[model samples]
Target: MRVSGSGAGSMWLQLLLSLAALWLSDANEPGTAMTTRDINQQTRESISDYTVKGHDLSTSGSHLTTQDFKQQTEENISNLTSAVYSISIDGFSSAPVEENVILYSPANIALLCSLTGTSTDSATVNVTWKKDNERVESSNVTINETKNVLSTQYTLTIRDRNQMGNYTCVFKSDQEVKATFNLQVPQIEGKEHHVVSYVGDSVVLVCKSLKYTPINWIWYMSNGSDQVAVNDSLMPDKYIVDEKYANITKLKIMKISEKDDRSYWCQAVFKLGESKGKVSLKVLTYMTPLKPFLAIAAEVIILVAIIFLYEIYSKKKQMHAGTISCFFK
Candidate 1:
C-alpha cells in the first residue's frame, strides 16, 4: 500500500529511528566499530616520573595536581636537609622552603608549580606567590587552603616557553619560608599523533623516546576487538621489526582498508614499565558502498517487513468480507 499524508510521515520517522538504532547496535558487534574517543589519553596513569617532551598534556591554565603536596614537600626537604644540613647551612639559607613539591612527570604534559604549608595550632598559614624573585600578583595563580593545609598552584600555557622560569612559593608567619623551582621547557621526544593513509595505501607508525628504548612492541586496535602480536614473523603482510639498535619500534600496515581507520597503539615494553604512542589511520572512502554485514542485514530486514505487512493486509481483507473493520492504530 502507498503511504501518504501525516501517517506516511509518522511511519517514515519511525523507520529512520529504527535504522539509527540498528546502526548503533552494530557498534556492539565484534569487529565492527572502533571506539571513538581521545585515545591519546593513556589508560595506565600509574606512571613513574611523567615525561612529555614538547607537548602540554592539557589546555591553558590546567595544572596536573597532587593531593597532600605539602606533606610530600616537607618529607623531601627533611630527607635532603638531614643528609647535608650541617655543611650547607650558611650557603643554602636563601633556598625557598618546601612550600610545595611538584615532581616532574615526563609522561604528563603540563606546567605545574606549587606551594604547601601546614599549621596545627590554627589551621591556616599566610602565603605569597612569586616568579623570578618578583611579587606574583597575576590572576593566573590559584591559591587554596583547607583547614590546616594550604596549597598554591600555577600553570602555564602548553609549550609556552617564555612563561617557563624560576617560580618561587613563599610562606610567611613568625618566620619566612620559601621554595623555588626553575621550570623550563625541555626538548621533547615521541611521535605526537595522527598519520593519515588512504585505502590500499601503506603506512608506518613510529614510537620512540630519547631516555629509554622498548624491548618489545604490542599492537592493539583502540576498539579492543583485535590485538595482534607484532613480530618479524610475516603475518598477512603486516610486519614490525626492531629499528635503530632496538630503540625505535616500527609497524608497517600494508594495503590498508576502511577497517584500518582507527587509533592504533604501539606500546613500548620496557623493563620498568611501558609507554605508548597513539597513531590513527584515516581511510579516504570505501571501495564498496556499505560493509558486507550491514548490507546483508538491510536486505533481510526489508524482506521480513514486506512479508509482515502482506500478512496483515491479507487478514484485514478477509475480515472486511464479514463486515469487520481493521486499522493500524
Candidate 2:
C-alpha cells in the first residue's frame, strides 16, 4: 500500500497497453472472419439468383418461337385447303364451241369463270350467265373496270354431280360475244381399250359412262383421217350396235376381217355436250399364232436329218474297210 508515485504510474500504463493489445487481437480474429463469410454467402446467393433468372428467360423465348411456328403452319394448311379452281378467257378471241373440262370429284370446289375485254369507246354492256342453255339463278356475276379494260367474273360452287354442265357467258354490247365452259365428269374407261381378235371371230367393242346417262350413243369408225358414221343399215350383217343400258354401248363386230383393224370412236351425247372415247381393234389371222411352233418344228427336223446322214456314212466306211482287209488276207 505504501508505493511511490512514479512506480504506480508506470504500472498503470502497462496495464492499459496490455488491454489494448488484447482488444486488437480479438478484433482481427473471429470478427473479421464473420464479415468475410457474410460477404461470400451474399455473393453465392446472387450468382444462384442470376442463373435461375437466365433459365426462365430462355424457356420463355423458346415457347414464343414454338407458338409462332405452329400458327404459321396452320395458316399454310388453311390456304391449301381453300384453294379455288378456275378458268379464264378473253372476249375478243373466238371461243371454242365446245370445251371439255374433266372433274374427278365435284364437291367443295368453287369454279371461277372470267372474261376480259378492251374497248376504245365507253358503252353499256349487258351480261348474262346460263347453264346448259338455261339461265342460272345462283350464279354470282362481278364486273370490274379499270382504264379501257373490262373484266367480268362469275363464280359457281359445285356441290354434287348434278351441278356439272355447260356454263355460258354472254355479253351483249356493240357486238354479241359468247364463252362456254363445258364441265363434265371424267370419262369412264376400262382397264384396256385395245382388243385383239382373229379373223372370222366375233368381237365386242365397249364404252361406258358410269356416272352419266347419255341421250344416245353413236359409233364412228375411223376412215383415213375422217370419222365415218357406222350405220347398221348399210352393213347389217357385218356390224351391230347393242345398247342395252343408257350408260353402256357395245358394238358387236361379226366376222372380223383385216379391214376391221382400225380405231372405233364411241360418242356419248349428253344434254350439255358430247364426249367421245376410242377403242382400237386389231384383227389377226389364225396362222399368226402357229408361226412360232412351226419354226421350232423346222429346227428339230433339220437336226434329225443331219444325225441320220452321219450314221449312214459311218456304216458305209466300216463295210469298205472290212472288204479291203478280207481281200488282203
Candidate 3:
C-alpha cells in the first residue's frame, strides 16, 4: 500500500492547498467568526477532486481504544499486518495464559483489555466478555462492529483485588482459545527513596515498580499540576528518562538549576494500571559550598582578637598596681 506517481503528487498538493486555503480564510475574516456550514463548504471545495487510488474510504474496523493507537506502528494504511492477537477464555480455556497487570495507587487511571478474533473464513465471528465465569452485560463492555474479524474491549476503572481474577474474553469461532492476561496489579517492592544533589551536578532517581513491565515512564513535578507528563519537550539539557530494565526506570536531571528543587514523581504506565514513586530534589545554590569554611575561619579570627584584647588589659592592670605601690612608698 505504497502511494507513488500521480496519486502521491495529487494527494500532497491537495493537503497543502487545503491548509493554505484554511489559513487564508481565517486570516481574511475580521472577527474570526466562520460558521460551521461555511467552514464545511470551504473544506468540501478544497478537496473536490482529491481521491485515493486503492483504499476504500467507507470501510472501517474497530473503535480504536487509546491503547490500540499506542501499540500500532507507523506504517502505510494500505499494508495489512497479520492477525496475531490473544484472547483469554474463562474456565473453558485448555491452558493457562499470562496476562498480569501491575496497578499503581492513583486516581483517574483505567485499564483497557481487548479480545479479538481475525479469520478469512465466511463464518461470522463474535466475542463475549466475562469476569469470574459470569457473563458481563454490554453496558460494562464496548463491542466493535463484527466482520471477518471481531473484537471487544473491557475497561476497568475501579480496581479491587477482592473482585479480580479469571476475567476472559471468549470468542465463538476459536476452539482453542489464545493466551492469558492476568488482572492483578502487583505490589511495588521496597520503600520510598530520598535523593540529594547539588547545582551543576547530575542525579538519577531510580524507580522500580511491580513486575518490571512498564509501557511508559513519566516524570513530573509534585506541584498540583503534576499530572502532565515530562518528555523531551522539557529543556533537553535538564531532564531525561531512561529505562534500565522491565521493572526499573530512572529520571536523570542534568546541570540542575534552582527551579529543579522540587518534588518529582516517577509514574510507570501499564496495561492494567500505573505505579509510581516519589523523589525529592534539593538543589544547593552556588554559595552554599562556601558557608561551612567561611564560618570556621570567622570563629578562629574572633577567638584570636579576644585573646589579644585580654593580654593588653592584663598588662595595663599590672602597670597601674605598680604605680600605686611607688606612690604609697
Best-fitting candidate, scored by lDDT: 2
Model 2, span 10-119: residue lDDT tens:
99999999999987887788645446788799988887797666433345445445568699966655454233445555664645344566654433344455446556
Error of 1 at 51 (Å): 43
- What lDDT would candidate 1 get against the real structure? 0.56
TM-score top scorer:
2
- In the range 1-329, model 1's lDDT, one tens digit per residue, is 87679998999899999999998998788887755442333432322224343234556667444545577755654443111010111111245433222222222222232333334232344656677778878666666645544456554332233444566766565555566655432211544578877788888877765565455567655556765555567465665554755666677888888788888777766543455667777776564546777889999999999999999999988888656433533
Which has the better TM-score: candidate 2, or candidate 3? 2
lDDT of each: 0.56, 0.74, 0.62
In candidate 3, residue 275 scores what lDDT? 59
RMSD of each: 36.8, 28.9, 18.5
What pairs collide in candidate 3? 97-180, 98-180, 99-180, 99-181, 99-182, 100-182, 104-274, 212-246, 212-247
Off by over 4 Å in 3: 1-184, 224-228, 285-290
How high is each candidate's TM-score?
A: 0.32, 0.44, 0.44
lDDT of 3 by residue, 1-329 (tens): 98889999999999999999998998798988778898899877654534223223333774454466556633323243222234533422345455664343322222233333444342444556666777767565665644434446665443344544556665555453434445555545543657777888998877776545667777777656646567666767777877657688777888887777888777766555655677777888768989999999999999999999999999999999999999999
